[model samples]
Target: MKKPKILVVIEYIGENGNSTAYYWSQIIKKLNINYHVVLISPENKESLKFSKLYNVDSRLVKVGEHNKNSLISRLLGQIKQTKAFIYEIKKEVNNCQLVFTGTNPIVTMVFLSFFKKIKKFKWLVLVHDIFPNNLVPAGFIKKGSLLYKILNYFSFLLYSSPDRLISIGRDMTLLLEEKIKKGNVVFIPNWASTDKNKPENKNKNEIILNLGWEDYIVFQFFGNMGRLQGLPNLMKAIKSVNNEKARFLFIGSGSEASYIKTIIKEINIECNYEKAFFYGYLDLNKNNMGLNACDVSFVSLAEKMYGLGVPSKAYFSMAVGKPLLYIGDENSELDILLSEYDIGWKCKPGYSDKLALLIDNITDEYICSSMNKNPRKLLIDNFSEDIILGRIEDVVISTI
Candidate 1:
């Protein structure tokens, strides 16, 4: 059977796009057995890199450059830039039978792409990470006025009207229930690629001997250190963690980087970290080298985002089988997963002592058990992409 042509709609990608976009691109490839995928995103020059990195057939949509420096310019640029994207998608989707929108406000962009609903086209929306508050960021940008309420209501209306709504994590599905809790919301764990960059077991003696033997326990946090990552709590716990043998590692760049460093300086906590260091984000395939070098993996998110978006890092981190330390709400997806698997530690968002205690508790045996997480095993047993994608394919093919 000839594969159906699938059009994937996402925002910026390739040049350091958000992690969610990377996953969607992977999904496109995972489904290649069933679909011929065409990826569309805002990135132009980066789209080439994005294509190579994710190994997807990517086309740079003709959108205006996004201006991040000025507040007003940012909003205005997004609207105008994304509108141009709509023009391209509309023109392209004539032969495309199925359309998939990834976890982004870009669903709204897809909606705006249409003057009104086109007659027989199928639209499948995967809601990755959305918050009720963000349904209308225009509200905060504007004061407590009628405009805020109007935009919020409109945004909700747009979201609630989707044909099919899929949630990546269970908590996200529950949140969707609060609003439109009817026949639409579906739950699936985020899919991981078993084929690409499969992890290799490193012999500790060879690796350690090669590196000249580090005696400290390494606590590593990968991914962006954005505001919601509860980095402040991580840093504070690093401060309070009295063990000289415990090293706290912060990887990736984010808004909180400066503040975190400032606090580390204000309160001399270098002792808290046996060998404190900042290793900026790098390609994941290359960074797997660093993973073999680490003793533990840490994850955190802002308290406000607890139930909203399930952090993808938690699943992969656990797959790495290093003890996972995630800071978030008790009910958040990562917290629940970390606890259920007995894979690592969980602390409430913004609690430093919990993190400190977690750091002090890691033993060499614990590290060995954690690394046994066997990501491939977990995927085969729990979230196999073949099964998950088959389920989604049934939805798309049936819709068409």
Candidate 2:
């Protein structure tokens, strides 16, 4: 018998070497069901390569450039692309057995709200980032404003229409339960690519040598350097640290990249020691090597961002057997996991003094080495691809 088809819709499919695309590609390849992928992205070499490697029927709806600096441009681009996407997928929508998508592109949510009402396919909504709720904390929108009320209602309608709402963290699941039906919400934490991200020696890694970090205890933050990461606090913490044996690396690009550079320049004038280096975005293929070069990984979130979104980079740090230095909410899902597993350290946002102290304390050779061992074991036991995907398979089968 032929396998049932699943339609997976996403904003960008491995475009410009996106890591989420790489991670999802692994999951899509392993899925037993036949699947078709629809990407709302500019037609590019990376997208074509992604489709070929995944060996799936893929279609791309051309969209304008994604400009992070211009909110109006971003929205207009999505609106234009979404219309094309809806038209392209109209014929395939009714033929598929299920539709899987995440809360991205804004357009995807808009599409789901309409598609769920007409199609008989089981709608699986992956809540990667909560909408208007997350925006209120980030100061993008006022809570009681007319725009907020409108967006909130739309978000509620979108989320409630799904057959199953898959959340990335326990805190997210609870929040979803408040908006969505309790029975529809499910918690499935993101997984790491353990097989792809093995531990590597810092001395032998080319990326480390290139950055002149061969002798230092590196604290690296690799991924989107956006407002929600609380990067200003991290930069301040690194500047305050007097330890010559330690170095900080910021890799990746976003709206905050220019701000990070400005901060680094100010630190350079006052601090004699070359403490921090900012390396803008690296491709997905080189991300593993970049991650392996670090002695410890840093993951941060703004205080107000707690429970709204979880940093997926935490899993990559663990997969590579590197301990984390997290600066975010003390009660967040990542904070609890780090404390429970004894794999990393956590400090509250904007507490640069406390973060500096934590960095200074972990300089001991024995302490750092011991903490590194726990992450790999933790990855295998809880966050491995096979383990998480097995649960996902169960969810998919149950939906059918």
Candidate 3:
């Protein structure tokens, strides 16, 4: 049987890139078994490694060096990067039978949607983050404004262009239903980065031992401390917590890092709970230690954050058999998971009182004895890389 060629256009895919790069690498690895896969991206060592390991044909795009000091300079640089990628994709897209991509550099994808109308190749889009609409929650743009309507019309076009639209969150699939036909969307949740089927022993973690947090019930929030995470609400919840033995640990750094630290300082003084600490970004491989060190993993989304995106860290937290303490929209994906599996607790983003009450009641003894025996089973059964990629492969092959 002749294998159909698939050209994957993405912005990043290497050690330099974030977790999404590793995710696509896994997806490509699975696709390589039955398809002729070609990749187009700016050069990275991991991409080169994939070229050798999976027999994927690599096409490199030039990424412009951008000045980060000003918003205008950064926007210009992104335009240059997008132009370079479009040129590279155009050069190779004709040779491939299918084009596979996610919504990074979404502007390029929007432009590519127009090209899809003229070309015969099948297009598949894996929706990670919904745009313009997502921006509305962050106060980036007004929902019904001229700019929002214009970008949303193009987003509709982009959604309609794909032969198959892969949605990571069920809420996202529902949201896309408004833009395109329901038959075109497929729901597949993102998987854990770790392959482990069981929890790592906290006693074995050097970081936990050195920090003297062995006696406390640790709640860890590790990832981008970004605007959309509802971090201010988390600070409010932390301030309301009265449990002296309930420690909070932050493992990643971003825009709200300093703000979170300032709030932690206030909490330490006002509440006299000196257990909270902000440990700046650690290397990728070291994330396992941080995950293992915590009794519960904290994941939060800002108000009006439904269907915009699903955080990948929640799955990583599940992989380590840790219960999740989620704060986000009601009936969001995390809420659904919590309801189905008894995996953890959920509070609405703005309700710091509810989150605080939930936090104060969770004890080490209760977590160890009363909680689900194996939270990692969720990943093992449903969200593992192999399971997710299998679903994706079926979609691709069945469509072909």
Ranking by lDDT: 3, 2, 1
Q: Number of backbone collisions per candidate, in order?
A: 3, 0, 0
- The lDDT per prediction is 0.63, 0.77, 0.81
State the lDDT of candidate 1 residue by residue for 13-95, as single tens digits.
54234557566655666666567877877766667676776567666666676555454776677677666667767776878
Q: Tens digits of per-residue lDDT for model 2 on 1-400? A: 6677777777656623565665566656666344444433445677778777656677766666767557678788888877777876686787778777777777757876887777756888778778878887667889899999898888888788888988888778877887765578878888887878888887788878887878778888899988888988888887888777887888888989999989888787788656788888787777778788788899889877767888878898888888888888766788778768888888999799989988988766633564435798899899999898888877877776
lDDT tens readout by residue for model 3, 1-400: 9788888888767633467887887788788887888888876666777677667778877676766434468567767777888887778778788889888777677778888878767888889988778788777789899999998997777778888889999888899998775588899998874553246887667767877888788888988888889999998998888778898888898878899888888878887557688887887777777788788899999999898889988988889899888999988888888888878888999999988989988864564665654678867888887788889888887655
Residue-level error in angstroms, candidate 1, position 310: 1.5
Q: What TM-score goes with each of the models? A: 0.82, 0.92, 0.93
Which candidate number has the best TM-score?
Answer: 3
Q: Candidate 2: how large is its RMSD?
A: 2.3
For TM-score, candidate 2 versus 3, the one ahead is 3
Candidate 2, after superposition: displacement of residue 159 in Å? 0.8
Q: Which candidate would rank higher by TM-score, 1 or 3?
A: 3
Model 1 residue runs over 4 Å out of place are 1-3, 12-18, 43-46, 49-59, 67-73, 105-120, 131-152, 195-213, 265-275, 363-376, 384-387
